[model samples]
Target chain A: MLCGAGRDRDVLTQQLQRLGIVPVVVDAMSEPVAQEPCDLVFIDVDVGRHSPALGGGVDIPQDRPVLALIGSDVPSAVEWVIEQGACGYLVKPIRGTGILASLVIACHVFEERTTSTRTISELRHRLKARQLVCSAAIRIIDVFGIGEDEAFHVLKIGSMERRTTVEDLAAMIVSGELSVQALGSDVEARRLRV
Target chain B: MKSVVPIGILFSTQGPYGTVSRAMRDGAMLALEEVNADDRFDFRLEPHVQDPEGVPAAYLSCAQRLLREEGIKHVVGCYTSSSRKEIIPSFEKHDALLWYPSHYEGFETNDNVIYTGAAPNHHVLPLMDYVLRHVGRDIYCVGSNYVWAWENHRIVRELTQVSGGRILGERYLQVHDCDVDRIIDEILDRRPSFVLNMLIGESSYAFYRAFAEARRSHEALHDTVIGSCTLCEPELAEIGASACGGHLSSSVYFSTVETRVNQAFRDAYRRRFGERAVPCADAEASYNTVHLLARALTGTTPSEIEAVKRSLYGVAFAAPQGQVSVDSENNHSFLVPRLGVSRSDGTFDIVRESAEPVRPDPYLVWVDGTGVWASWNGRRRELTNRPRLRVIR
Candidate 1:
């Protein structure tokens, strides 16, 4: 499902097309993303950490498998998204067979029911997180007109420049307070041109 | 300058051995056609082919044939390490150049044989780094009783010992031998986390089936990992599709080993041979060897063996496996080691790799930083000191 919030739909189309995976744009909590019926979901999304008060907007449904595109060398960013609810995470811009591998891993992970937590609420929270991350990703993609990998880098570079943190920026995006328009030039351009 | 080089391909056509012979030949033929079609060699290189049908004696005979009837001075053939051992003397006797194309048991050395294949630097130690992480402890090494098995097992034993894994079991099958049921029984009993298979030909095919059929889970076997440098594109088809999956096969080339060099080689090969997949190092090395010989022949008179040898010794190229140069001292090459996991399509999905070629130390020694070659263990074999060459112009 294409995260409508930060999506370069054209590039998402091309990257997914290359891997033979096509994107369908929608809110993660809505129809298809909610039903968990997609053979697989290629989630080039942003995510937020968990907090008790104010109930951070999204939930993680443990039923579906999600492949997240992340930034390289930033272990914290990976940790944050994975914590939110990415079954399999790949650093961007995804090149070569990395996308295929992430898709495979995500499918296997969900099919195996191998996520660490067994609680239903935890599963719900994870799925909700996955959806918010998706929305933020769509926004990034729309503004950047780049692949999932570049959208991911935009979030990562924004976090670094904002001097706050990747998790916070990802959370801010997921919370619907920020848009892809905030991305810096360095973040917009990565391995491939934006 | 237009040139022609006679190279021999030693393969088996009958019984269980024909698969490798066919695949290696196919890979080479495709490469040759493309090389001949291109401007790279200025379309000047022409290759002469001979197939010995996997017979060592026949290989020697073919070398004699190429050297005598064909008037060929330099050659590439003999994929098996054992076959290479067999033909070394023929090269020495005839003063002809033999480019030994497969990663072999590294202990052998001959001035006439230029190995454009993996040394221990290319195969053994790189896998050792993997063993330390994934496998919990023991590594079982299985192979055929021959020079290749012995040399490889020795190094494997050392690496396992250093990694703190016991050499739980060491089993050997005679060449061209395949005793599946018995070998499987021993594997089940010992139940080492992983087995290092050095068995070549039909035996490897048999062992892979026997191991896969056994009811064992990956987690239970997670600590065990089989590392075989001997198994390449040729063995993949023989072992069948389902059997070799997820098992790591180390080599200088795998069909899926994506590099600028390998990709170009694969495309040229596929275009020339109808999109065929080549898994054998011997075939790829054979492909490179012909081009090397063609250059040398073009540069000088094709008639003399010594002149051809000099040209080869001094020659280097941007090879598909990377920029491999003949070690002037050892008649060897330092090429990169690439390792991959077997997939369903009889190719490997490259898992880990070295971006650049690792110079082959004919005897897998760790050379120092000063560009001075020294013993890895500091206990120099007679080979440690080759005939010292002096500048005498």
Candidate 2:
């Protein structure tokens, strides 16, 4: 829990413990709210408001889920906490009844967002690799007077022989680090005969 | 030696919905009397009665006085959702528990309150199925302008929209405003399959009377019926004989629910409150509340709210309705839903009932398996193709 010293903080700690969640307490006002090695962070905006470090500057880290422990339901305070990027909130004075629900919601939302981000990144990587392979295949088709499918087959054989990915071999050929004729069995056999 | 604990009873027994609220208060009082007479508990509950007089502001003051001035930790009261919400913050502030006994629109769970009533999943969702299957695909809605009406209409709209049903017309009016003649006329003009009546108290009764008066000679009024989630024997009695019969109601408990437990409960209630006493869903809920409180206070000090809450966990009561239990997580009760038709004598004839008690799903996590969507084949269809109805004032 990245919260400062107060009754609200104590109650929150006790509530988290009741839920069998052991919180690593960090005074966010005195310390910075950053990548903490914890599953979730419970920030006390009421306490942290006193310290300019949290009140004025530090943004709540998005790496782990954040649950704001708010003392007031005033629209501005709520909006401020939401602006600080809170996934969920528990109205203070903190009660045991609300902690579990807020924690569950914040963690679930964070995990879902994280999973979607990873999936998007993986899809981008695959797209980039496909583009590189296609570029290398087109170059081979122009140089060897072979069909695009035949060029891809040659790249596949070369990749297998080199124990590298087809995309990596394609990159090597496109970069001029490896010759396309060297990948052709016909050229290889002729060179061997010579 | 029995340790005496003071509890609070807050209800508006003289409000627009006073007839039904009085029944609930009587039911709670009967349970208290029974518990006091019983030797099973080592503790006794002394109730401090506070009437809100059906005023919303009065509820706040009454609940505050009970929890703060009286120093009572447990309160068994609040008939309407508005009244319940009014007193909830005070209950939470005082760390007291409010026993709310009413069938209401769901989507709330508070630790400071124990809801010993029907959740939407147990009442309206199941009723939606019965209406769609037994009634027709087209419906007209009439309701008192309130949260209960608005929320129920939303749920019914969702249910009907998904199931190839159409709502012909919808209307709302202020509480106690019996200006339902125009709405009733609109209903007749549209001639929807049935009317979903969400109007409470006198307004509801007035609507029934007006509808009956307008459609008295029409033979089709028999099939073109009124369906409700709030209708009960007491309300039917208020509606009078001319317009009472042929209406369908969905509730957790009907005075007509056939069971040895229910028969005994009904007899005891009548004997205590006189032969005129008719138990309804809210009344049974209040009765369950007192008994559950007694059971929870078995060995623990009733002063400690946490201890009482802990003791209530997994506590099940063999209530008049059936086997009723509180879901410890949300403090809402598990209840069996029953469908009934109002008979000529202002009593219901239970036509359908659940085989077992259904767990409370206030957040609607459990999609009712008895709905139309469950029977539908996976084919996408536009909601526009179905007949459309306009909501009238």
Candidate 3:
């Protein structure tokens, strides 16, 4: 838990111990530090103005759940904590009863959000790759007169011979690193007898 | 030569939750007077009373005037959690003690305040056990929109969830909001086996009357009892005889406790405040606070906050409720928990009582089995592994 040294931190530690969780306390005000290995990171939002996450210093892993320990219910404090990507919050003074509940709920929610974000990022990468491959296939059609399917087939053969992914081969062709006409020469040599 | 100490009495006797606060003030004053008359101490307690009138903002001003301007160290007051919270920073700032005498949704333990009341474990948890055992599992919670209501409902929700029960509906209204007929009608329609009421003052009284009036036609609603950890005699009177009966209240004290100590307390209260002055849970708690303060002040200098706090440790008062004592570690009282059914005469019929005064678990470490010992003593102690057995309430 990234919290200042005080009663709130002590209370939170005690509460965590009661829930069978012994938290690794971090100095929130000290030099910028990465998130310690833990199920949840409780950030003291008020003291964390210089936190790495805010200044884009150290990236907190998406899977690591962050629960902000907020004292004031002011709009700015709440908005800033939310902006820092806090999954949930434990209201300050760190009362005994709600700590465990917040941990359970916040971790569950963070995991769900993390999973969906990873899925979306993966899908976007794949879509970009497919678009690159399509662009490379079109380049093949323009450089060497061939139908759409024939152009795609030539790109696939080059990708296999190069022993690289189709997306990497497409990037090479798109960037003019590999000439489509030179690749078309290989296809012509193979089809010479026919 | 007797030492004279001026004490501050901060109670809201005019605002939204004033009916109960009036009774609480009366109780505090009654104890103060008794302490002055008693020869057990060579000291006199002079009370300077201030009425916050139920406004949360007023509490800060009143408390500041009492603590800073009036120069009083030990002030006994506050009814609602919000009011107490408002005044706490002032008490801490002045290095004074606030003898907060009321049963609340207990999650705090500040050295500046001594809580001489039922914690959630003492009241709400037991009430939940009773309601879950006798009453059906499905509950509808209706409360006043405040910390007390929110925290108590949270406790109820946790216990109910643990016991494999469900909350059918939960609702909240403003402290003075009286438009509860719709909520009552909805409660009747849902027909949960019980209603856990956390409403205070006018809203609470309104709920009882509206629920009673609605139940008059709806016969099936007879089985549905409204259980509250906050309700007591003064509130019952405000609720009136017509609507008071059939409600279950869990408190540390009710006027109907069949003990000589209670009888003496009731008699003294009637004699000093008149017959109309009824004692409720908070009233008893306020009375306990004054008595506890007087005992703590017997030897210690009034200005020494640390001395007074140390003197409070291990001291027990034969309060109207029973033996009331502050836990040395947490500053919350260990008192008996009693469940009562409201009688038509603005009194409770004591139905269930803990065999002994249960230790105050203000942070609810034991009740929730959080197993986390709140190291108020500066060292992490071994956790108590007391398994919560199902007690037949």
Candidate 4:
């Protein structure tokens, strides 16, 4: 927890202890804490913004889940926390009551957000790969004078023959590492072998 | 000379959920009358009543008119969560406080609204405990397709899973849809230990009557019982005599709570609305809402929403459901949870009750810990008996 020593921190620490969560409190002025080892990071938005230890601003690690401790609901304060990629927030003057809730909800929301982010990235990669496959298939069509389905079949056969993924073979064909002509010849050679 | 405070009263007295809403309105009216007569406060509450007729759209318009045209700062209304959700934006936009008085599936806290009802932890958690202890683990869920049903069922499912129990069957019917024969047939086929009835208003009444009839014919269903958190005394009357008794309900207040304050409240309610208008949990909460509002407005100006809200925090009332208070943190009430069984005469027999008011955990963060289920006094350990996996091959 990167927070200044105060009632909010004390109350939060006590509550966390009660919930069986061992909160390792790190003062904002202390040496930079290794965030990679931590499961969850709770940063005080107000303090972290001014703290030199946090590099004068809260640098929320992308891999770790963050929960913001906010003292003010002003748009700027909230916006700052949101920009920091905090999954959840606890309003300042933290009471013992909402700590568990904030923690649970924050973790759950963070997991969902992380999953969605990962899914989107994976989908984008696949989309690019699909474009490459399409480009390779079109090149095969242009070079060999075959139908679109037959071009895709030839690519599939070439990938199988090369012992590579269809996407990898498509990339290889698109990059001109394995030319479309070579792919067509490979498909023919594989058919003759069969 | 008493100052007249125009209080907005929004309820649907003529729709699918009208019976309970009528009772709620009556409860508010009763408290309004009491507050006006008491002379404890210098201001007299004048109710500017509007019936939305259970239409979701009408709630916003009615709430808007109340807050804008009527210039009412405090309103005690809303039976369904959807209606409450619809008008909340209007309340927030107008900077008015909506004194919502109905137990709902929680997970909400708004500065513009004071929830004077049982939160999920205060209602469903205790009910689940009772069901798992006395009733059966295999649950068959049937609810109206709405947020209230969905959220409550989610809690039930979570608790059931944590306890190593099973949800045998689940179904969601449209609001006010009474085509429950198919659901009943499915329940008969599954033969669940208990039916978790999340259906509201007319749909609930229809299910009760139909299920009762089905139970009479099916010997397998004789042991199976219907359980609900929304079932109240007025709804019990609607369910009719033969089907009403033996059903379990979890609530903050029941008309049959044998307390001096409750008895007096019941007597006054009967005197005001006559024998037909029964006081249920929502009615009691509505009654409590008005009283709380009156208390908050004792010396404060009605137009100042912030002052009224500030005054409302941590205010305790000798409510029909014991000493209920507003949680300073979450505007929800700290209410005593009670488990009751419906009687033939349209009242609940209190089976179990908390020793004191349980703090309202709207998000259920406290009741359910970081993990899906927290240790609840070793009850989870006692209840969980997982079947061991064996190699069939």
Report the TM-score for the A-chain of model 2.
0.68
Sorting all predicted structures by DockQ, with the top scorer first, yields 3, 4, 2, 1
lDDT, candidate 3, residue A140? 80
iRMS of candidate 4, one decimal? 16.4
Candidate 2 structure quality by residue, lDDT tens digits, B7-121: 8998888979998899889889999999999988777789899998888779888988998999999999988876786578788888889988888887778899898899888
Candidate 3 local lDDT, B216-335, one digit each (tens): 778777677788887888887787887888678888888988789999888888888887767778888888899999998877889998998888895888877778888988999888
Instruction: Estimate every model's Cα lDDT from 0 to 1.
Output: 0.62, 0.78, 0.78, 0.80
lDDT of 3: 0.78
For model 3, name the residue pairs that clash: A18-B372
Question: Residues B1-393, candidate 4, lDDT per residue (tens digit)?
Answer: 999999999999988999889988989999999999997889899999999998867888899899999888889999887688667767878899999999888877899999998888877788787777667789999988666776677778878887888999878777778888899999989999879999998999999999888877777877787889999998887888888888878888888887899999989998998866678998899999999999988778889988887887847899988887788798998887877778778887676767677788888777652221133221122222211100001
Q: Please list the residue runs of candidate 3 whose C-alpha ends up more than 4 Å from where it truly belongs after superposition.
A: A1-120, A123-194, B368-393
Off by over 4 Å in 1: A1-194, B1-9, B13-17, B38-47, B216-223, B276-280, B367-393
lDDT score for residue B78 of model 4: 95
**Candidate 1's residue-wise lDDT over B1-393, tens digit each?**
645444554455543456665666665565566567766564344456777776655766777777777766666666665466546656676777777666765655677777777776667666555554454457787886555665667666766676677887777776677776676677667777667888877888888766766634333433345668767775776777767666767677666655688788877776665656564576677677666666665557655767877887777777776776777777777676666667656666665656566666655556321211121221111211111111001
Best by TM-score: 3
Query: Proportion of native contacts found in each model?
Result: 0.00, 0.00, 0.00, 0.00
Model 3's CAPRI class is incorrect
Model 4 DockQ reads: 0.02
- Who wins the DockQ comparison? 3
Candidate 3 clash total? 1
